[model samples]
Target: MLTEAQAWQALDAVEDPEIPVVSVTELGIVREVVAEGDALRVVVTPTYSGCPATELIAESIVDALKAAGAGAVTVETRLSPAWSTDWIADDARAKLRAYGIVPPQSAAPGGGQVVRFMSRTLPCPRCGSTRTTRLSEFGSTACKALYRCEDCREPFEYFKPI
Candidate 1:
């Protein structure tokens, strides 16, 4: 019988398909791990709906648990309470930055409503400068935005805040 804690620890070895620098748990994708009888169930919430990596992530989880000596591993997808960037672990944020992807920032209190109309300046992941301009609303992935640093003159991807 695999313990919940053991299952989570095993999952630590599973990295996010999109961001290889961080584990799925570090990315806040693994919400819950429970052992039910002989089966281990992993609950996951995707960064966003319609994410192309969802199926791949699920398969990775199942394979990881099985390889860890788990019995009858099951993956459950939960989308009710939409996943938010706020759920991202602080350590994961640092990893993302170190990996050359700007991490998402928490929405300002009472500033969420205005964000829809106003654009926010994103600091460059490489140069650490706020004087970055958006090259496009989309980047290498649908979840990111393309930006170029004014100081470094380098193009980078900003993990869009959700």
Candidate 2:
């Protein structure tokens, strides 16, 4: 029988469908992992309740554990406390940057980030230019925002603060 640690290790291999740079574990989606008897139960929370990845993420979790040798896997989603960026592992943050998506700065009390400055400056992930401006708060994805890099003249998206 595999231990809880082994189960987590198996989960670490499951990458986020939207952002493959980090695993669902690093994204703070998978909250709890418990092995009871021959069955393994996992608790997951979506970044946003309406996020499309919710269902896919849960399926990935179950598939991952089962592939790891668990007799049975149960993926549970918990929305009570909600998911926060604070749960993101530091290593995952670095991976986000390396993959060109700037990880959120910090987790605000509510669902948004604590805006300390006037203008939010996100460097262009493509051209490394700070001349990026927010085009819109919404992007193709629910969790990102549209941005345009003036220097590179390329349109990109900011992962937004969570």
Best TM-score among the predictions, by candidate number:
1
TM-score of every candidate relative to the true structure: 0.90, 0.89
The stretch of ten residues in a row with the least summed lDDT in candidate 2 is 109-118
CA lDDT of every candidate: 0.85, 0.81
Error of 1 at 25 (Å): 0.8
| Model 2 Cα shift for residue 94 (angstroms) | 2.0
Q: Residues 68-128, candidate 1: write the lDDT tens digits.
A: 8899988988986777777788998999999999888764234445444335678888778
Q: What is the lDDT of residue 22 in candidate 2?
A: 91
Which 10 residues in a row give candidate 1 its minimum summed lDDT? 108-117
With a 3 Å backbone cut-off (N, CA, C), the pairs that clash in candidate 1 are none
